[model samples]
Target: MTSTVVEQLIVPIRRSVTRVFNYSRNVKGLKTHLEELSDAKTRVLHSVDEARNRSEDIEDDVGKWLASVNVITEEATRVFGDEDKANKRCFMGLFPNVTTRYKVSTKIESIAEEAVKISVRGKFDRVSYRPSRRGIEDRSHKHYEAFESRGPVLDEILEALKDDDVDLVGVYGMPGVGKTTLVKKVAGQVKAGKIFDVVVLAVVSQTPNLRKIQGEIADGPGLKLDAETDSGRADFLYERLKREPKVLVILDDIWERLELDDVGIPSGSDHRGCKILMTSRDRNVLSRGMVTKKVFWLQVLPENEAWNLFKKMAGDVVKYPDLQLVAVEVAKRCAGLPILIVTVARALKDGDLSEWKDALERLKRFDKDEMDSQVYSALELSYDSLKGEEIRSAFLLCQQYRVVER
Candidate 1:
């Protein structure tokens, strides 16, 4: 098993190492861009605009390019830094299927003030930016969407559990509407806070496999279940979970209603201190699985909120002065879908209007296809357009399951 883990990792690790090597030259280019931006004055005569354009080309392109690269590297590494199994599973397994959302704990004043510094807007109330807080700009605004975890959403969910009146809590939304993301966000904080004696987060795909799920639930409380039989595994799990004073189990992406007893995982209700949180696309599924608590429904992010979230991950790449109008039209087409926002934004990260227009056309024809592909496509150009294009192309084209990228 350990060897299998190493084998699984070699490919991505090698790919990462190769990326580091292949990008060394490009990294040097970043230094050159920095040198220019460092010296470029903010204010110039109107007549120098065209000449400035000619001179600032290196800095403009390199600044955005390196900034984008840093975005991916830093974001991917932090979210995906688990040492072994979690990292291995997380890179493709955990993160690809899910994006996280927590509450924004920052006050309105700070958010607005920070937006001014970044020169990005934080307000989404109007089609135009309010002039001096009382008027509007035809094409200016203070806010866009992001997939970042926030503090308020986190606190609300954690507190909801504390309310005894709430039972069989459910977070419902369409597939990839961040149902999984919400649960995972909560699970991380809850586990980190040591809020419970045991916390287990498991990905329950469409199959609803009891055997596999039993193994997963039992993974909590440090109990080793080398048991081969389903019943044996269940027995061990029940014993381990029975004594814990506080336990929280997150059953992620539950496709259908399942009897917890049959699966060998106990709902916290039995012990007065346990809680089971779930994510599902179907309300019926949540209702059926309402073992001990009520369900909470999550809607797709509102148009403004969704765009804000997507634009944040997308960073400066999507905010081109050149493609602003066309991109807004394209963003509208996403119909406030978080997955679509992410997928389309990622697909357009290269900042090519022509390519972006082509992708918009593609989305028109195949908008409802796998959200994963759309999201991955957003990063396709940047991650692919670099050198070693053939290697990148080959590795990406391979099937997701059991892919050995090395």
Candidate 2:
């Protein structure tokens, strides 16, 4: 009977010592486990495929799991660092150490169990996820000088942008007719209203540099392209743009139809919710080259609007009763062109009645081609406002140089 009692006591005591020894070794291995956990987390975060599937739930789960692992690893390191002391503390006078070792082993085992569970939960399948969008830079300041006549055109463009079927819209007009200004107003309104998830504006000058154009467009969304070749950059752009649910791309000063595919812009049936707004000097570029869904032709401002704009630029000069009549004639000479009107009006501003008369005479003297007369005559009026012969001669020399260079 005594032997049976001894055996029962001995078996439990032996098992307890073995558990303590095994747990001590496992605690040492916790550092390795922590390293693995950290590496796994970095892999998941940087993986484009994994990022696509990233969600709030997954982020929270990972965060909590990582925090818990760090805590356990730190505690285990401290405990295992003084293993000899822990072993000594386990013993009591004339009694085998069972309670302390048992407690330590259980705590370590509990942490290890949790670590396993987290590892399993952290494993995720790749899925589509939204790319981080760069904030749209506000351009409302440019719209301050927008012409009054552009109100109707701005409204029409805004309405067309809202239509589900119209993915591409074009604004075409003569140089300095406010094509850029009108589009800027539209872009500002769209941004303020949050009409699209992303809005990008790029200038495609007469000669389109594919890479430069791509860089500008990519800048809007904060996309960095590391591709060496033009086609590679386009490919990168295509992939990035594909992930955006709604985007508006504005191409200003386009001389010809840009190859949508070459630029990495999706158009036609594959456009998704993306919309393209462009401005060009030629209507043919919009209708034939770009094959835009709708084209809005921006005409020169009317006589009344031109006069109002001229007065606005001329300031207090137009308020003078005597100068008012001459100012009206100067504004009319601008021929309803905002650029010409603003230039000529500002030149004659604060000038005496005689200066205004001289400007009118110089404008009438220019009998060049119709377009040349319209543009250069107004410019010449501004040039004639110079105070002295030396200044005027220098100005004319510069003008001559400009013509030669052109």
Candidate 3:
């Protein structure tokens, strides 16, 4: 009986141990599974973060693309529109329809408002882009003076030319104030292309050289003179220049009447029909040329314009975080001479505040009696290099006059 009892106790203990071992194995398996699931979730979170970063990158690329498209569109619009249209918002003025347009009316196509398309055949009166508003409204006069000027000066010249033999229309201004610029722009407007069929641009300077004048006239359309020789070149220029009907001749800078007929410049038409545009500094020179017509004088740039021009010429070196007052004071010293503005700008382009201050002090102490000593002479050296005699004299005369001739 005792042996049987011991056997039962042994059986119960072995079964209990087996059950405990099975339960422990199951618990370990469950813990391992939980750890694996946690690892998988961490990987998913990392992938989600990567996707968000890629999306942001894509958005930035798209924004850049949009900006590029906008720039291209603006450029395209500007290119397609007509620039010569009278109604276009040019900072300067327009030339009146003088003889006939040298080219097809480019400005006509650019008209945004209710405007008319004009040509030589279809009009009783000349075409013009008359101002809707008056007196320098939204116009940048200084910038126009520097690069190009097509304005009221041209309009009067063209009006004078309509008589068919008007000989001279002088556009006189100071050297840096844009007299030559205006005359050149006017020549572009009045010369013949499709409508008028003739355009003549004769650029001369202070002392007229017969050969240069002859060559200039001969180089235009419908004529090519052998300007290599003095006499033959003159004859060729004179004969052809006389033949063109309804012509606009620019004797750009005439210190004197220059005896246009004497130099191979043809003079067949009565003084009523032919038109000449001359620019010079001396009011007496211009008055002698245009005795009957009223004259227009170009002025110095306003204060703001002079400073802006100075800054542009100065370039990246003149930038100072704290020297704006110094800049304004220096700009004031320039008064309104575009040439001086450019000179100062080039001088100070690589300047600091110290350099700016130094320049201002120098100009302040400049000899008021001798403009030539301070500014005009420096500018005149640049003018002296011009091949055109008219340009040189005109530049000198401009230096002589501080105010415009009425």
Per-residue lDDT of candidate 2, residues 1-406 (tens digit) = 9999999999988877777767667666555665676676666666634454443123455556557666766776665655554465523555435566667776666666766666676675642334544333344444256566788888999998989989889999866677877787787788779898778888898788899889999887778799999999999998898788888899999888789899999765686678999999889999899988889999988888888899888898888898888888888777676666765666566689998888887767567555456545655654545565543553464354225224
Give the C-alpha miss distance for residue 4 in model 3, angstroms.
Answer: 99
Could you list the CA RMSD of all candidates, in the order they appear?
31.7, 7.9, 32.3
Name the better of 1 and 2 by TM-score.
2
Provide the global lDDT of candidate 2 against the true structure. Answer: 0.73
Ranking by lDDT: 2, 1, 3
lDDT of candidate 1 at residue 46, scale 0 to 100: 28
- Stronger candidate by lDDT (2 vs 3): 2
Question: Candidate 3 regions off by >4 Å?
Answer: 1-158, 161-165, 191-196, 227-232, 267-273, 289-294, 315-319, 367-406
lDDT of 1 by residue, 4-92 (tens): 99989898767554443433243344344433432332222222354444332232433343354444345334422321322233454
Q: Worst lDDT window (10 residues) for model 3?
A: 112-121
- Candidate 3 lDDT over 281-386, as tens digits, reads 7667778654525466777677777777877877655466577778777766766777667665665665677767766765566465765333433333335333
Question: How much lDDT does candidate 3 score?
Answer: 0.52
**Among all candidates shown, the one with the greatest TM-score:** 2
